[model samples]
Target: MVIEFDAELWLWEARRDDSWTFVSLPVEESEEIREMAGGQRHGFGSVRVRVTVGSSTWTTSIFPDSTRNCYVLPIKRAVRRAEDLEAGDVASMTVELVDI
Candidate 1:
């Protein structure tokens, strides 16, 4: 299934403590995805997906965040540079939920 939405690209603070960057998925969108992905997920409640931001598209997995009640998309430094994205930047993303 494919889910598309726009959200601000924000860094996960605790993750950054370990030097990782993440983009948050809106709560509503995450809910929809959960329904669609029903009973299918990987380690850490992660759902595999192909994500696109700006002109960059890559395959990755989004992990559910209990604190935020949503899913967080990991954005590597390479992706950030290719998309010219930074923390707090609004990004339009398309998520193709794979292995669902």
Candidate 2:
């Protein structure tokens, strides 16, 4: 989900393995200009982080679920539960926009 107010778009973050991917947010250097020009400026932003035994990553997402705003990792072999990670562990994530 995306929060848009007077052209300003506020998107939450989503987490993947090594890097993060968002729906509409620009990650590539080439798209930076287009993204900045398309929307109004935002004051602050946040990225979601997931931590595992081996490593940690963070990403931004477009989800608006207040309870689950971030794309959490599934409980599996590579991705574990949130409780399993330590305080310092980190993950990568990104944020973008989603059209309803």
- lDDT for 81 in candidate 2 is 43
Q: What is the TM-score of each candidate against the true structure?
A: 0.86, 0.19
What lDDT, from 0 to 1, does candidate 2 have?
Answer: 0.29
RMSD of 1: 1.9
- lDDT, candidate 2, 20-54, per-residue tens: 32222223421442344344322233223232223
Clashing pairs in 1: none
Q: Residue 29 lDDT in model 1?
A: 84
CA lDDT of each candidate?
A: 0.83, 0.29
Q: Largest TM-score belongs to which candidate?
A: 1
